[model samples]
Target: MSYNDRFIRACRGERTDRVPVWYMRQAGRYDPEYRKIKEKYSLLDICRNPELAAEVTMMPVRKLGVDAAILYSDIMNPVMSLGVKFDIVPNVGPVVEEPIRTKRDIERLRPIDVEGDLPHILETIRILDRELDVPLITFAGAPFTIASYLIEGRPSRRYLRTKSLMYGEPELWQLLMDKLGDMVVTYARAHVAAGGKAFQLFDSWVGALSPRDFERCVLPVIRRIFDELADLDIPKIYFPGVSSGELLPSLKGIKADVIGLDWRVPIREGRRRLGGGYAVQGNLDPAVLTGPMAVIEEQAADIIDQGLEQPGFVFNLGHGLFPEASLDKIAALTEFIHRYSARQLQNGAAAKEAERA
Candidate 1:
């Protein structure tokens, strides 16, 4: 089967010819070709330009032969579309203006007009779906992550504003979450309608909340987004970052088809926690790609081995590619996983059969 078909099947908890591989932020700053494109267009420009976005999205697939292509965009795009002002600073990540402070601030936030600010994202998806050979996945910021930005106003080491609202003003926090949940569902559904085959909800800051806080304040909203997208037939991937291992079980009620594991959680442990039915993606440390090819191969091999224990698995780095990662090493890892992991699986299965005989 083709890589895209294999990936889609695996995400649905079905067997595939081999483990499918892709990367978070696969179409970003690592590739020289991507850099050349960026010189002519800014990060926001490329995301807003369909042709440029499509070109960037296809670069990794062409260079590394990845199984899927994520739409070239950021977590804050939807927030920007919702009338919040923001800018992306080089190395510094996103900076948001007017942090939500009161019930009045939450009430003032507008609904996203998917047709208005995000038309280019839809156009890019249409272009990729037509031209690219792999499955095109699009993403949105999960409610709490978006809320974190809206509350804290930027990337924060301590999510003080977010927790203050959650713990101190419980009713207002729930109200904000309720509103953002509705927006996430609408945004994800729009991508599916525009030809995106898969959707990922990036809960990048949800780890800041305790398991109790997450279950009380965040889990229901995440579940609602996934449940709303359940009818779309596209797999939904929920990726909660660092120290989020405990949050895995809370995902049980959410209707997501895939669970994305970060490097902090081992793939075997994540599989054990998430159980056998759902497809799992990632857990490889993205930093390993910066090391020697041998080390990269060793880490990739281990992740793939653990992934095979599950019914469906898609190989990936735990998070977005670092700007300085070696593209050649990434290519080598992809080819190695595509080639050797299947053989390893075959040899193991044959040994089991011999033992049974």
Candidate 2:
């Protein structure tokens, strides 16, 4: 069976027949089938079982006709391999058994040996590689985002404890980042070697810091992760979450292929802000999917128009899909993206041909 490469091509600043569309967290909650699976197993349980994980990962692709499939593993999966105990508690996020703070906690962290610690995840990627024609995107949390989880134990609105550590113990903060960064590099390599076509570094909470703080406290480690993995030759996407539009200038030096945008920034404006060299993904408001169908169609088309004004654009939501997002809406939007972009590309080619004739 043939698969799609439009998403991969777009990520590399290459032209394609149409924009590729896939949502973050596309495989979970919204789908009734996934909810049935959830009744049988917890989120981490799915991650631990390669077959189950692959099944969940492919659900959105088969059902929604998304152009790509992200590995159905949590960002905290690698952290657990590093010896941190945590649970994906219902109604809450990752709740670390003991938060990391001092030098001893950092020292206690072990280097991830992917084969030994995460064979299940690698096997899942291998399954996806054989089963998927579209790109199999594997991702891990960015150092700063994972660091927040490690320091705070759970999700927080302000990330107060994380910021305090950055301000109060700069050296210790570097130590933690170094460990997590190295782990991300190794984990990413493993995923690629196992046949992942792309990788996304999800710094979902990194926007919590000010520009100065992000540069000082966070940027270096992320830079290292991308640099170390550059030779892999896969598209590397940096998802810095909301407020990342403001942080783009600071991140210009990082070696990543695409900068994901949240809905707060217009895609065209984000393209200009990123200095025009890299491709971009997203900036759609996911909430719109819950409203009227006509409104969703209008907004999705507008995003596509803005995205195509430049080269290397991928159509996606600014963030992950919410639990309540309509599956029907997702399918309709995807079909529209493929059809509309193809028509646009075809018409452009015909016009150029007429000029030559």
Candidate 3:
């Protein structure tokens, strides 16, 4: 139960020997081993295979020396059970076979049968729990993000169709959100029961909405999901990617255990705006990992220094890892975070002792 409590402690807003570091997409093509696997199997193929998925999930923890392991599966995986046909088109991202629009479309959506429909994913979590020394973070796409894909049918620069559904047909929007919310909760709870140490709900495209729109259309469903999961002892992380600083005020109503910040927001300022209560994760620019070691160290150190001021903080990139990012640089960054955080904590302890004397 106490395998790697450092990440868990940080999630609980407790001090640790060193700051825990884990990249968002740590098990992707950046790792040569994963690249080899990709050569043989497609992304979705690998995710469907519990044995392979478990192997990929553990690869990053073993290679990069991260403090935690996130389940290596796509957020769209759960939607397949909802009867929404989709494809993880190689370079284009998720492509829905039939985009949802009308009230009938929402009615057609089915509830996810986690154990019966997604047994492989649950088995993958079980394998990771039995093998990994660090905490395992299971994840699901938040209702809004999943809705964007469902409505737009693919990745979008402007979620025009998604917003149309929300603004034009609020009733249909609520119906869709209600269905997706239930699916997310069901999928996430099954993951926890199987052996996940924590849960992360990725609202990756939520920034596309204005604060008013988010408060009106998105907040309630997200609140419902977290409120449903509040009974679980594991920390629930909410990541609303990019341009989310303006929406932080509305996020206050969300009941997540940890609020993850994208690189656009400074950790210190995010803490101030978020009211400094719940644990926070991330805000590091992932591009910094490819820069010179000197620059990387300088930038990472700045984030670490500011993040240490928070009651609970976990070190992570603001976004997922880039395929072109250097593994050597990531390894160095991990080592530096541990060394730097350890020194900082030690100095704080010494200063406190000296003051006491």
- lDDT (tens digit, per residue) of candidate 3 on 227-299: 9999999989999888898888787857788999989888988887887678889978888777899998998
By TM-score, who's the top model here? Answer: 3
TM of each candidate vs. truth: 0.96, 0.98, 0.98
Instruction: Provide the RMSD of all predictions against the true structure, rounded to 1 decimal.
Output: 1.6, 1.1, 1.1
Evaluated at residue 352, the lDDT of candidate 2 is: 86
Highest lDDT against the true fold, candidate: 2
Q: Model 2: what TM-score? A: 0.98
Candidate 2 lDDT (Cα, 0 to 1): 0.91
Q: Model 2 — which ten-residue stretch has the worst lDDT?
A: 242-251
lDDT of 1 by residue, 1-357 (tens): 344587888899887767889998888788888888778777888888899888888888889988888898988888776788988877777787788889899888898888897888889989988897889999998888888888888789999888989999999999999888888888888899989989999988788888898998888888777777888988889899767888887776568889999888888888778755678999788888878988888888888888887678999878888888988888888899999778977887899999999
Model 3: per-residue Cα lDDT at residue 128: 91
Residue-pair clashes per prediction, in order, are 0, 0, 0
Q: What's the true lDDT of residue 295 in model 3? A: 95
Count clashing residue pairs in model 1. 0
Say which prediction, candidate 2 or candidate 3, comes out ahead on lDDT: 2
**Candidate 3 — which residues are off by over 4 angstroms?**
none
